[model samples]
Target chain A: MKGAARTIGRDLGRIFQALAGLLFVSILVPLIWGEYYAIPALVVAGLVPFAVGYILTSRFRDAARPGKLHGMIIAALGWFCVAIFGSLPFLLIAWTVELAPPILGEPSQTSTLAAFTNPINAVFESMSGFTGTGLTMTDNEEVLPRTLQWWRSFIEWIGGVGVIVLTTAILARPGSGSLTLYESEARSERIHPSIVSTVQTIWWIFILFTFVSILLLWVVGMPLWGAINHGMTGLATGGFSITDNSIATYDSVAIDFALLPIMLLGSIAFPVHYLILQGDLRNLYSDLQTRWVFIYMGIGTVLLTVLVYVSDTYDSLFTAFRYGSFQFVSAATCAGFQTATDATNVALGRWSAQAQLTVVFGMVVGGAAGSTVGGIKLIRALTLLKGIRFRIADVFYPETAVRRLKINGRRLNEQEIRQEFEEAAIIAALWFLFLGLGTFALLIMLPQGEYTLENVIFEVASAQGNVGLSAGITGPESLPTLGKVMFLFNMWIGRLEIIPVLVTLRAVFDRGGLYR
Target chain B: MTVSDIPIVGDLLESGAEDRVFDSLLLAGPVLILVIAFLGRSTVTVGLAAAYVLFFVAYVLYLGVRR
Candidate 1:
């Protein structure tokens, strides 16, 4: 009993340290915003956790070698704390401070604190940004101060790399156990077995990508700040755009084309970056997930384009193909910067159900394995496909015949394939289950709102998959409070890949799993 | 982890140590433009904006430093 109590305290202490570091990094935004309220908020948020942690772990600081159990606890708790505290700036600014009233002919009102600054809305916005889900609960986002706006996109950038991954990568002592925990969080693709070196390599490559993206966006005529913000958000696969229409605001074919490469790059796993760094470019071709991702993207684009063309929505074939391909790639990569809205395109009565299905299918496949992008992941898709094939073959052969399915170059025995299938099945089932429940709940909450079954499912799926694509239902001024909360929970679970939430719940309820 | 392991996080630590005000200026180039527009100094805003971009380029280099 005593041991369990001590363990819980120790876990919270470590979690608090990680939260402090993240909060410290995030609080810089408010400082730049020059909101005087920010300082007190930061101080209170930082110190409360620091005090609790310092007191809890004061007795045995040396016992902080967090096992997987502790890792799960830290991740869940750390995310909860960050989201809660990250909301402070919004709440503080919304509540206490009143900037000068808007002058005439300004873009919009600078601060609609009365309408959008509630705790639920702030947390919803922060969660959407951090999870890279891009389901906003507020509108007139342009009116938000540049600093607060940056903070929203900035959360996505930080959340993209993940606080726990960064903590274990930077702070945790590298060892077999820590590496296992790191891999458990799915950050593992060890470019090098040395954990710190792996983290360094991954981040270094990520930074390189960010630089290239910024230069490309600038060259394509985006302003410098917009370029930098989009670069960070895009790399993280968190699609919070500065403009209200998202990528649609650019309206440039070049901009749309430029984002394809960026989204594709974002969708590939970090380990592939390591492989490329090690001068093994062929590994890209050899990767099962990479191959399937391309296949999915290509098939989805072609089919969606066909639907758009056949429906004759556009005067020109080029426009149909362009928008279709752009949206298909965006959904597939889970980089949900929409270049066109489904409603507008669909209202012409030109977009076929086939096109809609293709987009949803792309959303389900998501990006490559170990990516910042979300969904069941491409590797799971490939394995699940192979498992289905193996089952078909087994049905044809005698019951006694043994079958092994090969994915990429590796052949997996029945047990491995079954285990992989089970994992994929569980993920898919829970995903749709959550979507169904979320949609049903949203319908009950906002019965009079204009949400359709398809759009609601699409929004929930976008949140759950961490795919930021929307059917135009989610934005600050549009969605109800209950709808926003549902999306927030979806984003949090989506980023943690859902199991951590289950582990967290089980920890609270069935305490036996704490030892395991 | 030993004392030797402590410095692995040194890069983030060092990069975080730049003058906060200077760094804030570099980061706030966009915000600065909006402020200057409000202050009715569009010409000075443009010049400062150019300088801010230059400073930001230098800052990016600083980000790459291995101190």
Candidate 2:
């Protein structure tokens, strides 16, 4: 028991050290922007974890072997701590702005920082950023300082790939614990044999894509700062925007076009990216997940366009297709950017019920597995669909006949097929169960007759799927404390893919639940 | 080769047109409510809701008969 505790501590120490490094890097944003007051806040935040982690690592260095159970616990706890630490910059910046408004050199925006002073709101924003959920507590994001804006986008960029993966790439030496930690982040398939090399390769691809995206956005007429911030969050499939109106504020088709490919690239699995990088175009074309994504996008776009046109939401078929296709791709990829109209504000909120439902469907389906985006995942959905077909076919086949289920050209034996079906069913059931529970909770908490049950379900699904599309329900100021907390829990669960959180909770209450 | 020989396409074709129609309706019924609600057609909403409920009842009966 003592040894186990020590092992947990050492693993936690690695997480803390990673947090400290993130904080240290975060200081550069404020320092460069000449927001000196925010620097001390970041430094203080970094120092606390750095000190504790240093002590823990020195003392418990021997306790280094952490199995799957430890991995889940560490991931859950690590993310929780990172969210708290990430909130420091927001909290400190808010305090500094309130106490000394002139230090930031923007008097008009000083009042905006007061929103972050509330611990719940600050943590909610931080959690949203880190989980790549892209929901914001700030009512008018345009008023936020450049430093905080950069911090928001930066954390999402880090959290998009994953915090544990980042630590493994830069901090962890190759070991059993390192591999377990990497797997705990919901990334099982490695592009390379060595976990370290896989991490490095993923980072390299991520960095290369980010640079290309930024350059493309800048060339398409976005300012350099806007391009950089949007580029990071865009490729991360994180929907956080520096503007009050998200990507709608740009109002440029060129910018929209530039962002679409970046979102798609981010939504694809890293292994696919590596294969494509190795010049395997055939693999890219043949991959089941990729094919499913294209099918979903094609069908969804056509359906959405027709619905929006029939509803008379847009002026013409051309406009309908343009907006419908963009929003569909965005929602499907789980990237939250929306094309805007001058009169309607966010065109998404103004969409008809059928169009909104289409978007919600896309959000629920999400992107490929082993990607930054969140939802049920195409792989799981495919498995569920195929499993049903297989079962039905089995009923028709002769008892003596051999049956094999295939996924992505790989045949699954009896045990593998059963396991796949079980996993898909279990996760899908849990997803809907939680979605229903969250919608019910919101319905009870929200006032009657103001928001429809459909809208409530849509909002809940958006939160749980990490899609960040709102139906006029999820503003920081307007949402009650319970509602905010519920969404926060949903985003955390969604980002971790629901199982690890369940495993962590089970391990906590049942004691030996993980081992059993 | 027949459509039934294709992979995912084959499965869908084998499921029969009746199953396909029912499956699509099952998926789209709730969404139809949202559409009606958004349009603010109260009379249409009532009709749609009644139809949706009836569709479910029929589906249950069909499943029972098939079993």
Candidate 3:
């Protein structure tokens, strides 16, 4: 017990230390803006975590190497702590700095940054950002301080690739059980054989795409800063935006179309990206998850366009296609960028129940498994679908027939098939179970008659999926403290893919303590 | 890797002819955006969109055939 606690605590220290470095680097944002009032908060947020992390690691450095359970615990606890510290920037900036100096852009009458003064809102925004779920507490994103905006995007940027993956790539000591920690983030496919090299390669791929995305968005007429922010978040598939209404604020068909590829790039697994960059572009179609991502995007877009058009949500098929394609890709990738509900295109909340549910389907399935998306994931969805067909076919065979299953490219024997199917089945079952519970809670928690049943389900699915396409139930005013807390908890588990959070909970709730 | 016995996944990774057609559709998505982004799509956009749908349907039908 002591050994487990020691190792988990030590690994968590590394996580905090990495966060501190990121926080310190972020201080440059305020410095550039001459937002001196915000500097102390940034410094303190950095120092507190750094100091705490320093104490823990130095105290526990020589502890036993973390086993997988310890790694899971560290991941769960690390994200929880990171959200707390991550909220400090929002909380402190809102409380300490007034709008008198007015950090950047045209400050609103009531600054959006002020919403963060409430700890629940602060941490809620932090959790949403770090989980790469773009549900915002802020009413107007542009009115927030540039530092806060950058902080939101920055966390999403790192959080999309994952904090553990980043730490494993850079801050981890040579033999500190990087593999288990990496796996704890639900990341499995590696670009290289060595874990460290694999993470570093992932980062390189991330950085390369981020640069390209930024330039492309800029060339398409987004200002340089918005390009930079969106570029990071877009490629991370972390959908935080600096503008008022996300991509809708720009109202540019060019910008929306431009981001489509960026979002898609993010939705593909890093290993596939590596293979393509390494000249095996065939993986684009040949890789299982990659193929399905495009196929889903293609089919979902068309299906959604028809649904929207028939529902009379849009004026014409072309208009329906425009809104449908962008929104579907956004939801499907779990990136959550929205197109405007202009005169031609209707917003999702106002859509027919059938039209809205189509998007819910996309949100629930999400993008490729090894990518930054946060749902049940495509691989599990594939496994579940394939297993059903396998089961049906098995009935046709003889009772003593040798059973086999195959998924993606790998052939699986009976035991492997059972294990794989069980994992997928359990996760899918638990996903809908919690999703049901969340929807039920929100049905009670939300203001009566304000939202439909589908709206509540959409919001819960968005939160649980970590695909932040809000149907009007997320905001400081939108939900009470309990609801905000619930969504944040949902985002946390969703990003960790539920199991680690459950494990961490079970370990804590065990009759025996976390440590002996 | 034997592709025959796999259920839905087998339709993909079926090799040669099927993969080539599907790749065109995959490549088409991004390239179509580039076309619209540079030259704002008018009637040609709608026409291209129609062709895109055709390709998707054809690709599905082609590989979706039962062995």
Candidate 4:
């Protein structure tokens, strides 16, 4: 086959691999649920397509690793297929439950599932889970089966690391190129030459942090299970709280404070932490991205705290600061756990609007390039900031002169800086555009006017940022089917970092095979 | 790909201990506030945590400056 045709085939195969992985993982949930009755059918449903995909990909296994753009294509296609297959567990579970033990007098044989069983709602929940967005399809959280709830948060943990990364690591592939691909997808900085070593190191560090966080939570009087579960989700920056009220259920300032470090660490990039742990400590300072994330969090927290305090929502200034800081980190890391009622309380809830917007902006800025956290990322944010400053300087000077932008003390050429800004701006703009469209569409559908455009915007931004903050507008009962689907899509795209999914789709449709 | 095997940190310290200390304080200060606020579960807990966090943060800054 010609190079162009070969490229097309390669992209398709890659896309299928992602889809298959998602389906495979989704099927595991039924096994976890001990629903043995559903296993045979779920296996058949999931494995048939996967087997076909596996057959197709065997030929392409030796294809030279793809370029960065192609890398994006693989990531995007994988997320889309995963999101679609991720819905299976939701559909099967919801269908089985709604069918409810087969009506007694109706011959109690094998039963058919309901047509409007809200599979889309379940898909939204699953996508949100996998994408690390805490948005939900179900309303009454306490009523949902414990196994499924754990599965949702578990997906958040799994999705934090690319499914391929976990699979590749378990299989123990030590190739540098494979390592590069895995690091690239998870957006983690490479800590070692070999991909497997880097992945293992990252996981090791992540586990260590989680263990420490669990200890802190437990010391603060949280149940051991909640502590462990919260530690896992919190460190991943994937906010899927077990309790319906989120962190609010604890009602302990200690629990909120205990979570603060975990969330903050979650928001910072892993590479920075790795460097710090290595005792190179200077990377912590010389790293522009790390510095700015702290600056951003500091300013945001203080501002939001003052807003909360002045709004008279809480009696004490410390209470205001406590919740304010927690909300900021939650949104900044795109984690979205809330310690206070964000939507209903007119004062603190109202303050959340501003806090949520700031976080949406932060999510676009994101955490460090390698961290599990989502959004545009801090490096891009720093790059854009530097570029903007340089552009302003150029306006004052003559265009004929060379203008260089420096981040942390190193200089980058104008063209390189411009390219960085262009990438960041394009992704950020697209993210907001999707959020706007999703919010407007939801507003048109829902008859209830309880939410303002700001509220809808906040929720959509939350979904897009993969930040879980809600204005009490989402969940299975409140949001219609279409709204849930929209949110789910947003979370998936946001998690994949947008470009990959788009490139993958373009590859799928391009007649000229110009996807690259 | 791994920083553990590389020498990126070797170049970082050439900037000296002052720069390192400054950066650490900058990063640690906000984290401190967050930690205190989080640990203090109530309004009173927040107050106490805030006081403790503030004192520690100030001490860290002084140490950084001294370095």
Candidate 5:
């Protein structure tokens, strides 16, 4: 147990160090913007965690090597730790902006940075940013200083790739349990033989895409600053936006449509992208998840367009299809980018229940497993669908029948089949469980007349699915403390896909040996 | 040997016709909706979309036979 503590502490410390290093890099944002007040805030946030990390690592240097369970604990706890410490910037910035009022003579009175002074709200915003669930506490993001906006986008960009991957790729030494840590972050595919190499390749691929995404957006008439932030968040599938109304502020269908490819690019598994990038263009069509990405997004777009058009939500089929296609892909990819902002410029709150429900299905299904998007993921959804057919067909088979299950070109024996099926079923069941609990929580806690059951379900699914398509429920001070906390926990568990969170909880309760 | 016996090439060409069809479907989906949205979902727009679909189908069939 002492040995376990030492190893766990060491891993967590490394994660903290990685986080601090990212924050230290972030100090340059405030520097560039001439926001002198933000510098110390970022520094304090960076140094505290860095100091804590250094102490723990140095104290636990000779601990036994961490195992799989340690990886899960580290991932779950480390994410929470980062989110907690990550809130410091939001908190300190809020206070500094309030007290000091932006020494750079930047926009002061209108800034919504004050909302983060509340610890719960601060943590909620931080959690939302780090989880890549872009549900925000601030009502007006346009008034937020450039430094803060950069922080939000930067964290989402990193969070999309995951801090653990960052830690493994840059911080942790090779053969230092990188594989388990990487796997624990719910990343299964290894693009390279070494886990470190795989993470590095993923980062390289991400960086290349980010630059291209930025350039494309800029060429399409978005200003360079907005383009840079949108490019990062869009490719991350992390929908944090600098503007108050999100991408809706532009109200240009061309820009709305422009982000679709980048968002879809983010929704795809990195390994698939790697294959296509490495000249295996055939994988674009043949890869199971990639094919499904197109199919699901297409079907969803068609269905949503019809529903919105028939419902007369947008007053015309053109407008309906515009919002429908973009919003559907945005939701399905779990990018949570906004195109559903109608002429009134409100979000999906005005849409019919059927339309919102359609988006909810997208939120729950999310994108591919290895992608940054959240929710139950397509692999599990496909597994459950196939499992149903396999079970039904089993009834007609003879007692001595020898059957092998196949999925995505892989043959599975009996145990493998059962394991995959069970895992899929458990995740699906748990996803519904979390969503149900979240909706129930909001139902009792949230004020009435503002939102309906569909809206509540949509909001909860967005939070639990790590999709940030809100229906006017989430806010900094507007929501109850308990509700904010609920969303914070929902986003946390959702980003980790429920298992790591539950594993951490169970392990905490067990008090037994981590290893069997 | 025939292409199927050489695994790698077969995998690479794994129904290139089908992939083309898939690509067309993907491309046509947005175009179909956009045409309706922009030009209205009138008979002309519907005809255009249907024409694209039919063309892709015919092309797939032609390619299938040729290969």
Candidate 6:
């Protein structure tokens, strides 16, 4: 028991140390940008975690390696800590901006305090940023300080892959429970032989993608600042945009096309990225998940285009197809970039119910597993599909007959197939069940005639799937307290891919299960 | 060979034949209620929504036990 406690303590210390480093790095944004007044707040945030972590690590010098459960606990606790510390800057900046209006820029109609005055709103924004869910509490994003905007995008950039994974890539020493920590983030595929090298490779590729995306966007006529911000969020599959209208503000076909590859790269798994980098195009073409993604996008886009065009939602077929394909891709990839004609109206909000439902389905299916994007990942979807096939095939087989189930050219025995089916079914079931519960909760809380059930379901699924396609239901000022809490919970669970959060909850609540 | 002894389609058919009516009813109950709720907005819709929720919860518990 003592030994286990020591191990847990040591693991937490390592996590806190990583958090300290991240917070300290965050301080540079304000300092470099000459927001000197916020420096003290940032410094305090950095030092507290660093000091506590340093003491714990020093005290627990002889701690043992962590098991899987310990790793899950570290991930859950690490994110929780990061969210709290991350909110400090938002809270302090909001307070400061409220006190002295001209320090950053022109004051907006809404007080800056509205962004963070309620501590829950600040934490919600921080959590949304870190989870790569683009839900924001900032009513006037354009008027916010550049420092806060940078912090928001930066958190999502780091969080796109994962915070713990990033720390594991950079700071985790060799053989110090590094693999367990990596696995805890629900990433099992390693491109390199060692966890350290694999993480490094992933980060390098991510950086390359980010740079290329920025250059492409800038080349396509976006302002340099917007390009940089969008590049980070896009590659991270994080939906936060500086403009209230999102990607639609530019209204350029070239810009939409430019974002496509970056969003695709963000949604594809890191291992697949590695393979493509190594000139293995055949694997990319033949991979089950990749094939399914293409098919889904193609079919969904076409159907949605037809639906929208027939409904006369847009004036031209070309407009319908353009928006239809963009929204479909965005939804499927779990990248939340939306095309808006004006500040308040998004293209998605104008679509028919059937058209919107297509996007919701895409959000549920989501991007590839081992990618930054979230959903009931494509791999699991494939598993369930294969299971259905296997069940159908099993009915005709003799009592003694044995059939091998294959996915992506790899065959699975009966036992493995059964395990896969159960895991896929349970997770998918829970996803839908929670989605229903959240939708129902929103329906109860929202005032009559204000929002439709379809819009509520779309927003709920967006939060639950970590797909940030909003249908006018989610906004900084409009969301109810209950709605905010529900979405916060959704983002937390969705980012962790449901299992770690569940394991952490069980370990915390079930005393007997903790030791086991 | 008999139809049940054939491949693919036969197997699917056999599976359908083997499926219990009670299980099918359990699966369909919530779906039907949800559809009804979606089609209209009234006291009946509210009742259907409640019924759907109850059915969904029970079905999830059933799945947990079966697993």
Which number leads on DockQ?
A: 1
Q: What are the Cα lDDT values of the candidates?
A: 0.68, 0.79, 0.82, 0.65, 0.82, 0.76
Candidate 1 runs further than 4 Å off = A1-12, A26-60, A98-116, A341-353, A511-516, B1-67
Interface RMSD of each: 9.9, 21.8, 11.8, 11.1, 13.3, 21.8
Instruction: Tell me the DockQ of each model, to 2 decimals.
Output: 0.06, 0.01, 0.03, 0.04, 0.02, 0.01
| Model 5: pairs clashing at backbone N, Cα or C within 3 Å | none
Error of 3 at A295 (Å): 0.9
- Poorest 10 consecutive residues by lDDT, candidate 3 chain A: A100-109
Better of 1 and 3 by lDDT: 3
TM-score per model over all chains: 0.81, 0.85, 0.86, 0.77, 0.87, 0.84
lDDT of 1 by residue, A12-72 (tens): 5655666566556656666765544545555665676667767877754545455666567
Candidate 1 achieves a global lDDT of 0.68
Q: Is the docking of candidate 1 incorrect, acceptable, medium or high quality?
A: incorrect
Chain A TM-score across all models, in listed order: 0.88, 0.96, 0.96, 0.84, 0.97, 0.94
DockQ-best of 3 and 6: 3
Which stretches of model 5 miss by more than 4 angstroms? A101-111, A342-346, A511-516, B1-67
lDDT of each residue in A154-247, candidate 5, tens digit only? 9999999898998887777778889888988988998877887788778766765675576566556676678879989999998999987889
**Which scores higher on DockQ, 5 or 6?**
5
Q: Model 5 chain A: which ten-residue window has the lowest total lDDT?
A: A102-111
CAPRI class of candidate 5? incorrect
Question: Candidate 1: lDDT of A93?
Answer: 51
Q: Which portions of model 6 show Cα errors greater than 4 Å? A: A101-113, A340-347, A512-516, B1-67
All models, RMSD in angstroms:
7.3, 16.2, 9.5, 8.8, 9.9, 18.4
TM-score of 2: 0.85
